[model samples]
Target: MEKMTLPDWMKEAPTAVCPASSGKERKGFLDRSLRNFASVLKRAFASGKTKDGPMQNLEPRAKLAGFFLLILAAALFESWIFILALLVMTVCLSAMTKAGAAPLLVRALPAIVFTAVMAAPAVFSFVTPGAPLAGVGGLTITAEGVSTALFFVLRVSAIAALAALLVLTTAEADFFRGLGRLLPGFFSAALFFTFKYCLILVKTAEGAALARKSRTIDSRGVKEAQRWFASRAAFILKKSLNTAEEVSMAMVSRGFEGRVATAPAGPLGFAEYLWLGASSFFFFLSFGF
Candidate 1:
């Protein structure tokens, strides 16, 4: 096999191009882009934006349980009525928690758009014998397909809303602690590490992005975009891997095994059981029984 030579950066990626910005505007753009990258990351994990609500006061265990039930109900639901009820439930909980409606929509809108993009076409997949509801643009839309599409949209929205509810209600730390309580020791450690490392990785990527934007123009053409992304991804991955190594070394030096140093949650009280019961009731009702 013959060895081949390519650009030195086929091996190097995100932070390799930390060239000086051309002007104050480029510098500001770099700063804002990096900050926005962090902001998106903060949202990805739990953030103060989503955590300032009454739902946050709920026991993490209870919220987790409710989330599971909400997902289940949403999954089993076939009717728009059930989905609407779940949405109403989401609204009520969000209101009670003082989580603003706009924020909830912001959290869920991405999921809604994603479901529409994928599910709109898939709705017609089932070949149930049904009359055409309408026809337009050379496509015959059937009643079954329309109904299926509606069901999928509702189900996805309800599930995403429930997930958002969890994020809105539970702090990342408490969520991990609650998970630690129920799960086996190793599993809990994994969850805690996953939560911890995700932020570190995001920051690493932001630094990488600042470096990249300083060196390259954000062109709209296909080849440019592809080159930009491929190079950035490679660079981000390198930085993230190094960051992980540093974090691991620091943790080890501090005697941090993967296990969390959390105080045990002790025992569940009657209220928790009561909350669990309520979650079950709502889940059943929402599933059309």
Candidate 2:
């Protein structure tokens, strides 16, 4: 093989400055947030796939009915103590379940925090005027407001905890199937598919974020970052529309009509009866409290 010499221009070209090494690079805020979100979703998806748990063997219909009744009680009950008790029981049940309490808490924490934040204004005299409990920054904090805010937060927490517990213990298919038995098939099917679609969307968004983060070298300015986020949001919106269309067409091709057919529900067993009784007992007991 003959050796070739470099051109004169190439030889005269200034040596390229070595790109400064950003040693021990830390993950950006957005990247960390994405990772946390993906992990939460993973935990949520994995929740009901377990083969062993306290509630795993119980029928989904039974669980659904019992949870529904308890949630209703939590909502209607006037006593904060009762709601708090319900929340405590839910936490204990979650501990007994294979999915554990940590993941369930993680799933519910955002909603609980949001509820607290939204209800925070209710503690001010302007929102719920009454005898003043304390004064802060020239604003009166009313006793009535405090009670109302406490009640509201507790109710929401109890209800949310119960819902999260149900999701944590039940398989997606079984849960939806049971739901179809309780609610109209059309509605259950809508909810089931919508939930699945949401998961898909989150996964897609996470992947997109990772790809963008991998390609990003220099930090972008605030305006640039905002523009990029807006563009990504629009892209996700468009993709969601296209996906929904494709899904609908595929369903129609597969013989899906407006109504979804569900399997016939079987007779309730001892466990089912027991669950119903316990739920009823708690609900009725609230009357006394």
Candidate 3:
């Protein structure tokens, strides 16, 4: 290979230009992460604000009831066709919400990929009638085992879709509204603000990671990269913990009483009753399959 030459200025770099050994960038990253994490937590504890047309009218209790019913129905289903149909149905229903089903699917694709990777091996591990593939690790793999794996994939996908539907359709404040009605007196039911802060924490974590990446030098090798990543992670974790404590104290100082209670769903009007019945009927038809 021919020798490559750099511009004259490139070879005359000063020794004083070396990176700071005291890790100022790393310290700055931790500080920024801590501040952001605290802010994120504050926002997360705040109740979800936006609401769309249909979701605005429904009682909080009604939405919660419907959600639990749907989850129960999905869980009871076993057939591949039934599970597939339910997943489609969830996406279809999700369209009525402002967030819509498409966005939900996009957000959930990561979990879908993970589930597929994890479940693929399990399918071929056990033998059943009409085995499709050979067994792994001493067990006889069969067509039945493979199909069973696929069945689980469909099952989880459907469940995830339904959960997504609830997120799009349900308001964060009313989440507690529903929870308070469903499980009154349960301490977990009183965690609406906790959920709010949790979102903040997630945002803080992301911000910290991005800030770290922007400031830190790229490592040269695989092992060095791993160490670099771990160091950054530890920094984030420490900052996040400190941030969380500050947030908790701030909330306590602000008179945040931890209790969630959904106002009762008053007697359903004729239209509300009709729609509720319709939803139940459609859900049952899907459930029966």
In the range 51-125, model 2's lDDT, one tens digit per residue, is 478676678888898999999889878888889999999999888876678867876888899989999999999
- Which candidate leads the pack in TM-score? 2
Off by over 4 Å in 2: 1-33, 117-126, 129-133, 137-140, 220-227, 230-234, 241-253, 285-289
lDDT of 3 by residue, 1-289 (tens): 9999998888884443323333345444444656666664554344265447575467766766676666666677766676787788777666765657666796467678888998776655343456456655776667776777788777778777777666656667666666776676455443754565566556656675565456545434567556756876787678768877897799789885665434555676665565567557646866566
Query: For model 1, how does the per-residue alpha-carbon lDDT over 1-289 read when each residue is reduced to its tens digit?
Result: 9898887867665552334444434434445666876888786665644446556766776768767877787777667777788888887888888776677788888999998887776444244336677666766677877777777877788888878777766776777777776677678787777778778777766766666566665434667656766887787778778877997899899998776554667566666677678768767876564
Which residue pairs collide in model 2, if any? none
How does model 1 score by TM-score? 0.72
**lDDT per model vs. reference:** 0.71, 0.82, 0.64
lDDT of 2 at 23: 41
What residue pairs clash in candidate 1, if any at all? 13-235, 14-235, 54-97
Looking at model 1, report the run of 10 residues with the lowest lDDT sum.
16-25
Off by over 4 Å in 3: 1-56, 125-130, 133-141, 185-189, 199-265, 271-289
Clash count, predicted structure 2: 0
Candidate order by lDDT, highest to lowest? 2, 1, 3
Give model 1 RMSD, 1 decimal: 11.1
Which runs of model 1 end up more than 4 angstroms from their true locations? 1-38, 49-53, 122-129, 215-262, 269-271, 284-288
Error of 3 at 6 (Å): 24
Q: In model 2, state the lDDT of residue 48.
A: 53
